[model samples]
Target: GAGVSQSPSNKVTEKGKDVELRCDPISGHTALYWYRQSLGQGLEFLIYFQGNSAPDKSGLPSDRFSAERTGGSVSTLTIQRTQQEDSAVYLCASSLASSGAQHFGDGTRLSIL
Candidate 1:
């Protein structure tokens, strides 16, 4: 796919384990976003990167969860000491700008035991 790509479509890990999810955005897209979709929470924004700078980091749910974008192309989300409540579909999207239409990937379904 030439668009947003997320790896390892599904994952299962025990509580207290750590997990890392990857997202590769479309070429030349300067803005990338991460979101979480859960049965109870619909879509919750996690984080995003614009160019090589991050203007916002408020959407992250906790200190245990963090993300970084390197070379302004690939992004990785890391969750430490995972809990059952952390289970959800992690979605990745990219656009030309913050307000532009976003292109999304199939998402990574994470399950915590």
Candidate 2:
């Protein structure tokens, strides 16, 4: 895809379940970021992955949230022991550099029952 691409656009699961969300950044992009947006709220930075540097997982709310970028391309976000609070739209974005504008995906709407 020419832009950021996310899959499993919608997901439903139980509170104790675990899920994985995937993202494919545009080719040649070096910076990738993950964000979460709850209904009625704006996006919150979850994590960031930049070429070769250690992933910035500081924005993650807890240990259950994690992400990784492989070869500076595809990335995945994992949520363990999903809770109702975890329900939100997971957005992925990519840019040529950290300071440039980003291109975002449609997002994955996750629902925890």
Q: Write the per-residue lDDT of candidate 1 for residues 15-112, one digit (tens) a residue.
A: 99999999999988999999999999999999978986754678999999999998988999999999999999999999997467999999999999
Per-prediction TM-score to the true structure, in the order listed: 0.95, 0.95
Q: Report the Cα lDDT for residue 27, model 2.
A: 90
- Model 2 lDDT on a 0 to 1 scale: 0.92
Q: Model 2, stretches more than 4 Å misplaced?
A: none
Per-residue accuracy of model 2 over 1-113 as CA lDDT, tens digit each: 67889998999999999999999998988999999998776789999888999988889999998888887789999999999999999999999884688999999999999
Against the reference, the lDDT scores of all candidates come to 0.92, 0.92
Runs of candidate 1 exceeding 4 Å displacement: none
- lDDT of residue 109 for candidate 1: 99
RMSD of each: 1.2, 1.1
